[model samples]
Target: MPRGPPAIEKPQLEAKKGKKEEPKKQVKKHVKKQVQPEIKPEAAHGESNKDRRKQVQKQTDELFASLDKEFPVNQMGPEPKQGPKTPATPTLMSSSSRPMIRNPPPFNAVVAGTAASNTAPTACRSAPSPPFPQPAPIAPAPAPAAAGQRDDEKRWDEQRWDDKRWDDQRWDDKRWDDKRWDDKRWDNRRWNDQTWKRSRVQDWRWKEEFERKQKEMDEVLAKALAREDAAAKMAQQERLAAEAHACMSQQAAMREEVAAQRAQQERLAAEAHACVSKQAAVQAARCLAWTQQCATVSREHEQQQQQQSDAPKMQQQSKSAPKSAGNWKHKNKPQPKNCHTNPGQNMRDGRRFKEIMQKNESLKAACKEAEGRAAEAEAKNKELQERVAKTAELMKKECKSGKDTLEKLMKQHEECKKELKERIQKLEARKKDLKERISALEAQNAKMKEALTNEQKEAEEQKAVKEKVHRNEDEQKKAAKRQKTEGPAKK
Candidate 1:
């Protein structure tokens, strides 16, 4: 690879040295320019000086070319050298070090490369090697023979291997068949063995004891189950009974309600009938009273007509009597002379007196008859007034009774409405209470079911454990019996 430029310490030092020298030279030139005087030279001297200036410029160019060759052209300038200790130029750094222009590695490429490198060692450490060399199998020790014990031990091992093989085969078969395995037959086989019989005899005794205990437990369970069943039945029966009772009560209530309604209806009907009858009676009484009034008015009118007719007749009689009086007056007027000597004059005076007395008696009789008719009419008018007054009094009494009954009916209707509202509220409250009780009972039932499930699981687990222990004891006993039988034969 091409190495980066060798660290140019000398170039940097020269550039720094030039920067210091340039400032000193500038100071010296400024002093010289200040000290030197400006002078006007002749044309010939000016031309000679121009040639001299050209010669000096040529020499200066040669010197500059030599310096340019020795150091770079850029090094000739009085620019400051960059160093670690030096403060960076703000403009140069800002322009050259723009963040946006820099090229960076792609994120995925960098990550993938890093991950490849990082995982290399881990792969080497974790990778499996080719199959390892097998370890030497350990040789089993030769078992010391205890006469016939050797055969028994061999038989026991062979039987154990057979049992293990059978168990493995059975497990595999069950898996292959997709069938459920039952321990019941295994448990029964263990239970039927000779050692298991002795152990079971002991266990049977223990089991008899346990059975006694279990019997007690079963009795207790049965009793508890019976109690629960009885309780459930009783509760069901109670509920049924209660429902029946409620139905009966409802029936009774309905009957009572019907009866009450019928009674109320009858009462209303009776009241309606009574009101109708009262109205009819009142109407009848009013009609009768009106008829009576009309009859009384007709009778009074008839009596007035009769009185008018009699008055007209009396007036005619009075007029006739007055005419006779006028005739008597005219005849008496022409007989005035020799009144004491005439017998005829005395007879005329006697006749005139007799007629005047008769006329006065007739007038008195007519006056008495008119007085009697007026008295009869006055009595009839008074009777009609009494009848009218009695009818008005009866009507007022009937109106007062109707108003009182209407007020009473309004009050009863309001009371009935209030009672019905109260009953509805009570029924709603009872319904809420019953709903709460039902919710509580449901929650209790859920808890009981959970407890029953847990208890059943525990009982099954205990049964499995007991069966395993019984099998182990039977196997041990069979091994012992086999050893004993083989020992005598070996001897």
Candidate 2:
């Protein structure tokens, strides 16, 4: 196999590969021994040396030819080496050595081309020798590091490679870093979204729990209110019952008093009946005594009549016989002076007996009339007592009915009071609710009024703007007309 150029294995490549080979050692020694910086010769301003100009032009062409084979170039540096004979062609160069052209071109281009041309100036009449091998391309500089860090200029020189290969490696590192940063950002966003979702769920659960608790509390309050109402109703009923009982007791006492009065009236009537019976017995005894006196008087009158008839017969017989003379003699013989002494006494006794008998008859007639009047009075008294008993019974009945009506009225009054109280409470609650509703409505009206006022202000501003625009347009129109008219006049 053919051996390649010694310039291919530069000391820079050995440092990058980190190899200790024999060829790399030999190359390092050779590079260290020939440590010279190449310089391009400048042209003189007024000299007319055609040979020197030709020599400089030839060296610059050879330098460009070797660089074209080894590396690709887009543009040359601003400051370039100028030749006296011809201008140097602008050559493309790698980034690492682009600045070095201001200092020196590489040793390979200088030694291979300029050395022979300068030494054998006369031998140039013959053809030139074969071209020297090109130098290897240099690597690009690395990107700037983090803050407080310096760019590694030496490392760039040590790892010299082609510009294309270095650009590919840089692009790969940039792509990897960008992908890692994007993944980290995406992960952080995902974590934030998860936390927000959990918070929302917790808030919803808490709201539901609060609503449930409120409902339970409301139900408990309603139950307590109902219990209180029931207790009030029961107490009212008990009070009514006690009132009824008291009324009944009062009625019983009244009935007892009425019964006692009836009993007293009955006893009075019995006493009056006994008095009438006794009066009747006394009247019957007086009638019987009067009848016996009248019968004895009649017997005495019959006896006296019989005695007078016999005496008259005897007197007629004696008057027809000698008894007449005897009676005259006996009468004459009893010549005791009766007409002069006993005549007044005998006459007074007969008159007094007749007056006493007439007085007894008048007294019996008066006693019978008095008995009849007493019987009428007793009958009138009995009628009055019966009427009083009937009136008392009517009064008792009225009292009992009155008591019953009073108890009913009392019960009705209690019921009405309870109903009125309930109505009042309901009305009060309704009043409160209506007041709250009215307040809310008034607030809404106020808000509406404010909104309407704002709208009116906005409308007024729009109207002013429109008016201003119209006035401006009219002014412009007038100005335009004046300009037209003035143009004709000036012309």
Candidate 3:
């Protein structure tokens, strides 16, 4: 018999001499009432095992209440406490004598009903015989002095007890088989529980690891992005610097070229000025020489005019009966000494006149030559003066052009300076912006590094938690395996 709560006995149908018909009706009515209420609508509708268990519990509770009321157990007092004594009842009608349905009826009885019916008869046959009846109520004892008969009797008694024990052992073996099946089911449930718990722990650990890895990857990507941005900004700045340097070099070269041009213009002007001064000096010297020569010619001409006047007067007096010639003839040749004296005197006078005329003609030719030279000199001087004025005007124009060019160059230089200043300011502003950006990037990078570190720490903690969970799961599995291996051996 299974070791558990005693069964509820159903009273045997025994006919009463006085009210057999009425008692049958009453018993049938009572059976119908009990059966109708026991088959609950909610229990029949239940789907899950838990719901079915609840239904079974409700039924068991009802049965237990009914049994407890029908056969209440008396209280026993504690030690040193006096309790009232009650009359002793016969043990013949105890829970052990109840008709027990050994194999519990299934909640869904339809499926198990046939099998239950088939096994019920067998179970009844295997049950112990009632205590009221005995096959041999009296047995004659063999004399103690007769050894052979006594030994025979004793052997027969022992054989009978052995057969009874064998029957009881067979019944006990069947009950043990049933209990072993239930134990196997309980063990399967426990193993499933352990597997579920371990799987849940593993799933949670995997989830944490996945999250940590994802976070780490995000941080790495962000750092890479920040680095790329910084590199690009630096490259841009380098390119700008190269451009600015190129511009400055170009400006310096242009300024050098402008300076060289201004110097060249100044040198040309200086050379032109020198040539004008040299020409002017030569013209002045020519004019002075021509004036002196003209003065000398005028003085000589006046002297010749005075001499001509005296010669004419002398000729007139000689023609008339020249006082000097007459007087000289008288004084030198006494009174008349021939006309030879007059002839000789006339010849000498003619020769002197011819010489004077030759001298005058020569002087006139020289004066005409001097006047022509003077006129030529004056023309050359005027031409020189005109050339000098033209040169001066050209120089003035050149100077004016140079001044304009210089002014233009100066304006350009100022403009270049202004542009350079603007460019410098722009570059400075850009540098400031880049510096601020770099600082911001640095701060952001630091924060990212810090966040990455924090994530690493968290990941490490998760790994530790996962390891601990794995260890616990391993231990639980080991214990479960040990229990499984030991269970049958213990049984």
Candidate 4:
């Protein structure tokens, strides 16, 4: 039984009854006097009694007025009777002794009736729960016990109390059944049969996908590597081509320089030859002048000898005629030949002078010829010197030109070498980039494979959740579909 308040004794109820009796007696006296006056003379004899009644009525009315002044009658209602002073003993009642209490009528019943009259059939159909019921009272659960208490003991006690009248056999059977049940049986079975199969299929699919992707990556990498190799080969070829071109250019330049040097040497040789020829011509002129002087001297000597022989013949004839008388006179008067002089000697002398004059004229003509030849030789020599000087200047210019050309060619070769070096550097950089990219792709592929492995495991879990028993078949269908689509798309 539930605990109850202390019981109320009989003495406390009697005391309350005695407190209410005075007000009841006063009301009876006031009503009895008014009714007795309505009867005949015999009732007139009850005038005194009526006076007493009036007096009681007045007192009662005054008491009621005082009560109304203190506490209005309109505010009065039946007061709740106090319970007995002693605690009440608890009593257990059967279910049949207590009436089933229904909910009270709402204050808006008339308003609801009017609204129901006004509502259309369609409106009424659409309105859900038109007559709402009062909400039920919610009971709070018992508070938990303090720490150090056994929770199982507390729960057992509460259950025992709540089901106090329940049959022990039924309770034992229900408890036994609940205790024997295994909640995870279906989950474990489903995971072993269906989820494992799904996981296996998914793993196979993931492996195939990884293999295909790896092959694609390998193909792309190979193509990139081939392109890089081709670029490197092209660069090498260009470098060799540039080197060969530079070598050929150098050889041609050397040959041209040799040719120029040979031409300069030939010019110098021709100049020397011209100088020797001029010297020889001057010598020949001098020899011819000496021969002419010798011829002139020989002619002069021959004329002198002939003149001496003629002079002696004339003198001998004159001497044989007169030795005595005229000899003194011939001696004194001088001989006629002696006086006249020898005509032959005079003729010879004249011839000799004429010859000498002719010889001198010839010598003078030869000297003039020699002078002219010497002058011509000198002029030619001067001209040759000038030509030599001009040739030397031309050779110097040519040499300078060759030097400038060689310098320009060297600069061009240096620039080409530099360009080739730059191209090689670019090729090396491309190779390095391709190597790095391949490494990055490999890392990404590894990461993707790890993720796919995890995803396949998760898919197995999801398959169990979705209760898909034929997980392997579904996976195979999906794999086939993906293969078909991906194959066409790749092409």
Candidate 5:
């Protein structure tokens, strides 16, 4: 098997955590021993100088041949060695994280070896540090491999000039420059993509969760608003019902009052009419009796005068006087009183009659006024009765119209024209039919839902049965597959 050049194992560094002093001492010691190996004197064995030269020549030839195969002559720099890569994710830190400063390992803690030794840690040639977090800059470990070559140099003094060319640190610097080792160090794009993919899921989940919470809140608010609206509607309905009851009671009271007023007015008018008629009859009777008495007294006085004036003529016409007496009439006072035998009695009676006549006149005037008042009262009472009847009819019509729907009230309003009202009425009828249809449909839907629930239950039972059969089939298939793959004995 082909293998890389063998390397001498160097001393390991013991850098304690949170410590610097101890590692510094160990590193110093390590550097001293590794850089300067002990030189020992050898006994002279008579080996030929030509044989040593031949061996040196052969090693040189092999080194050149290996170099030619690894690199073309055009590429002046050696190809950078690749180490086992670590994922960039391990070095990542959160944005809120503070930069951490740690104590670096002591310089030269690791040992240096030749390019052929694969285990050696490669040193970055550049002094500039990377922007991102990385391992601390490690100083190159000292190389003590030149001990064997040094012995060769001491033994063969002629080889000093050639040995010095290879021994100088400048040659090592040129071979291991910064640019050569920096190629394909880290992939920034891959780290960025991984970070974006990782955070995207969390961002989407948070967004969806926020939206769901908002929807729930909105639904809760909607339900609260609906409850408030329902409560308000209930209160309004109660108020309207109370008002209607009060209005009905008031109307009933008004009807009773109107009937009572009409009855009282009719009774008063009848009483007034009867009283006026009775008074007029009494006045007529008194006036007629007074006129008759006056007429009788005047007739008697005329007869006595005729008899006294002509005693011989009256005795001759006395038989005829009885016949003419029946035709005798007398003029009289408006309201006469009986005259007594004395003139003073006559004057007194006249004065009494005059007072009586004056009283009769006043009574007639009063009767006339009373009749006028009665007529006025009757007219007023008739007007009130008509008014009450009209009011009752108006109230009845209003009560009847009150039972009408909102559409009727809208029809009466001036804002709604006849054409619009007709259209509205037609639409209302259609809406009523639609409502009826919807109610019927809803009833049917409820029945259907019940039936659907039964069907769904049956379907679920069938699905369960089907799933069981499928499970059995799958189990059998799995058993067959298992038996075919692992053999039946394995189970």
Candidate 6:
């Protein structure tokens, strides 16, 4: 009769030649997780593998968004570029005995209804995935060899065991076909730290450039303001100088006019004094002749005394005349021309002095008029000086106000800068705290998943052991029954 399938044996791992083409185990446990991220969100409740994958993918997208936008990643196919460094891509193969599902199963069987769990996941059809390793099927324990068994029977049993081993080996090979890096779409791309460092350095350079531009703009604005202030000061100085020069020119013109008027008045006064002195001298001469004619008797009495005095004077003169030279002329010099020997000459001199005094009086009147004009000019000059002083004070006040405003603006700028710095620091601290909390939560979740997976493995192992024990006992009872029946028949 045709024999049945060989007795099943425990699944055993097979040894392979090389490691490159050999596939590895799968599931999140086998793959490495992303390293510490700069920014991380807190973990939330998730039911299935798809939810977890989506979460991790979102975080990865956020972290590399800048890079990805700047340099788009190639996501054309599942196969990587062909190079010596590139690893082989996984291929699906058909198999017998065990049915392979083209679609993925429901992630959470407990949450899904029984009917839903039996159905495949909808995502598998849209997206292709590599095969995954399944748990090894439970096998019955091997039957012990009979003591009286024939040589042919031993050979057949050995042949059956070999066939069973081969079948299990085939299953193992198909299950772990493409386990390593199969979960990631971009696994072929380079993940060297140098690439990441380059991107980070680029970002830093951009920030520095922005800061430099801002500083340059501030400097430009400051220079423009300074230039405007300097221009205003220069204009003010020019205007003040022009006003001062005009005032000085006006004062000089007024002084020259007063001096010219005074000179003209002095000239007229001198001419008038000369006319009065000549008229007085003529009147004195006329008066002197009249007086001499009236005083003849006095003149005769004076002549007798004069002759007595002249007798001694004439004798002295005659002696002095004989020794007279330039030295004798100097010793007996006649009375100086200014000496008032005649009464008429003295009278004319007094009259001339009086006329000169009267002319000085008239000149004093003209001087008074000039002084009045000077006072008026001085008053105008004082007004102009007051105006200049007022303008200067106004400029000073404006300058002080400008300085105060500048100082206030500076204070406000400093305050705002400090506030912004404080706010940025607080936000950074908050971000750090959130990141730390998220990392802790992720670690905790990983530990819990690991424990659950380990517990499942232990439970499955214990169940397999128990099943093997039960199968062995059943086979033992069957062998004993067969020996009892066959033993009687052989006799």
Residue pairs in collision within model 3: none
lDDT of each: 0.42, 0.45, 0.43, 0.45, 0.43, 0.43
Please write out the lDDT profile of model 3 over residues 1-491, one tens digit for every residue.
11111222221212211121211110011111112242322111122223544464476568657745764544211211112211111112123222122222111222123222212211111122222111222234433534544544454344334332332332233333222332343344545654664575466457546755775676576557656755765565565556556655655565565566556555655555554555555555655555565555455445454555556675676577645654875446443222233446546655765665665566556555656655565565566556656655665665566556556655655665575567557656765775675577557556654654665465466446545634654464355445434533553
Please report how far candidate 2 places residue 169 from its true position, in Å: 8.6
Candidates in order, TM-scores: namely 0.26, 0.35, 0.32, 0.35, 0.34, 0.27
For residues 437-458, what per-residue lDDT tens digits would candidate 6 score against the true structure?
5577557546654654665465
Question: How far is 369's C-alpha from truth in model 1 (Å)?
Answer: 4.2
> Tens-digit lDDT track for model 5 on 1-491?
11111122221222211222211110001111111122111112212222433465577668657856764455433222222222211212223221112321111111122211211122211121122222335434333435544443243332322332222222222222211222112122324543553465356446556755775676576557656755665565565656666666766776787678668767876776776677668767866766675566456555544544555663565555555545444212131223233457656656766766676677668767767876776687678778778877876676665545333444443333454456556656765775675577557556654654665465466446545634654464355334333431442
RMSD of 5: 24.3
- Candidate 4 wrong stretches, greater than 4 Å: 1-356, 466-491
What's the lDDT for residue 130 in model 4?
19
Flag the better candidate by TM-score, 3 or 6.
3
Write one digit per residue (lDDT tens) for candidate 1, span 1-491: 11111111111323332322211110001111211132212122123234534564476568657756875645434322211211111111122111111211112232233222221111001111111112223235454666445544454344433333332222222221111111232233434543443553364345436544654575576557656755665565555556556555655555565556556555655655565566556556655655575566456446544655565675676576656655675445453232233446546645654664565455446445544654554455556446545644655555455545545554654555575557557656765775675577557556654654664465465456555644653464355445434533553
Q: Supply the TM-score for candidate 2.
A: 0.35
**Residue by residue across 211-306, what tens digits does model 4's lDDT show?**
668867876876676678667666766766676676667666756765675576567556655655654565456546545644654554455455
Report RMSD (Å) for each prediction in the order shown. Answer: 42.6, 29.4, 23.0, 30.9, 24.3, 27.8
**lDDT of predicted model 4:** 0.45
Please identify model 3 stretches exceeding 4 Å from their true place.
1-341, 468-491
Give the clash count for each candidate. 2, 1, 0, 9, 0, 0
lDDT of 3 at 123: 15
Q: What TM-score does candidate 3 reach?
A: 0.32
